[model samples]
Target: MPIFIDIGAAYPNDNRVTLVVWGEHYDDFAEMINAVDHGNAWLSVTSYLEVYEGSLQMNSDNGCDYTWWTGVG
Candidate 1:
């Protein structure tokens, strides 16, 4: 069982990083980042897959958690 999510612009830790995915989907997001190398170009896409493990909650599985901070300070 794995969680999947679409990578998008986020202000987590003030890094302004994209979405964070777990399991086998991490690589996909990484690739997008590598392709688009520009000023805030990575902060464009939005997440699509919202469901997590058949639930509406985010579970912190150590470092395997697919949760990314999209909150504003």
Candidate 2:
């Protein structure tokens, strides 16, 4: 089954923006990077849909995970 990674942005004023991103569909990572680089903070991932072999999988037991890195060195 294919996995998905949903991403989002949030604000300090309790504003939360969400986005749904599919796994293996990161052909536009550059755009996402640019968006975050422009001062947009990620809020949280709402949910994801599982897929497999170019098809949606119903009984997939996979889940999403996240990792963060500080840009400052």
Candidate 3:
């Protein structure tokens, strides 16, 4: 199984493209976000999307409803 973390700005903003990272474990996936925040700057730090095993886990969207879905075009 794979876990993913997404970070970026939402709609109607001069945000950067969403950054996606993959890890096999949840802890690794979770910790990576902090590392990223420290190492770089996000266009929007107010929202984040996490997915585990191809399922949406947590989404704290404060912008234009940034959500992560699996294979739905």
Q: Which candidate achieves the best lDDT against the true structure?
A: 3
What pairs collide in candidate 2?
2-51, 2-52, 8-43, 9-43
Where does model 2 exceed 4 Å of error?
1-14, 38-73
TM-score per candidate, in order? Answer: 0.27, 0.25, 0.23
Candidate 2 local lDDT, 1-73, one digit each (tens): 2232223323322222233344454443435544545553452332354444444322213343333333423
Candidate 1, 14-56: lDDT as tens digits: 3233344455554645644344433333234433423434433
Q: How much lDDT does candidate 3 score?
A: 0.38
lDDT of 2 at 3: 32
TM-score, model 2 to reference = 0.25
TM-score result, candidate 3: 0.23
RMSD of 3: 13.2
* RMSD list, candidates in order: 10.3, 11.8, 13.2
- Please rank every candidate by TM-score, starting with the best: 1, 2, 3
Query: What would the C-alpha RMSD of candidate 2 be, to one decimal place?
Result: 11.8
